[model samples]
Target: MKEENLIVRSVTKKKYSSYAGEITPATPNLIQRNFKAEAPDKK
Candidate 1:
C-alpha cells in the first residue's frame, strides 16, 4: 500500500472531459473550423 499511495490514488480517480458538451447536432465539423493554411504543403 505504498508506491506513493498508489500514485495518489490513480491521480485522484482521473476522468476529465473538455469536449465542450460533446458537440452534437449529428456531429460534423470536418475542418469547417477552417484552420487556414492555403500553402506550406496545405498544412
Candidate 2:
C-alpha cells in the first residue's frame, strides 16, 4: 500500500512539472508552435 501511494505521488509530481514546463519563458516558442499547429485545424 505504501509503495502504491508513493507511485501515485510521483506521478502527480511529474504531471505538475510537465505542466509547469509549458508556461516557462524558456519554451515560449514551443507554446507558440503548439498554438499555430492547432489554430489551422480550428479554423
Candidate 3:
C-alpha cells in the first residue's frame, strides 16, 4: 500500500461595502429604475 500527501490552503473573503469605501464619492444610478430594453440588438 502507498500513502498520498495532501495540501491545504486558506483564503480571506472581502466585504462589498469595504471595497466600495475605497472609492471617493459613490457613483449615481444614471439609468435609474428604467430597465426597459430599447431593442434586441442594443440589448
Per-residue lDDT over 1-43 for candidate 3, one digit per residue giving the tens place of the 0 to 100 score: 1355655667879755645445578798876877778786553
Give the alpha carbon lDDT tens digit for every residue of 2-43 in model 2.
866654344344334434444544534545555455556672
Off by over 4 Å in 2: 6-43
TM-score for candidate 3, residues paired by index: 0.33
| Backbone clashes under 3 angstroms, per model | 0, 0, 0
User: For candidate 2, what is the TM-score?
Assistant: 0.12
Q: Pick the candidate with the highest lDDT.
A: 1
Error of 3 at 5 (Å): 34
Q: Rank the candidates by lDDT, best first.
A: 1, 3, 2
Clashing pairs in 2: none
Estimated TM-score per prediction? 0.17, 0.12, 0.33
Tens digits of per-residue lDDT, candidate 1, 1-43, equal 5855654334455588666765666877777878889787674
lDDT of all predictions, in order shown?
0.68, 0.49, 0.66
Top-TM-score structure, candidate number: 3
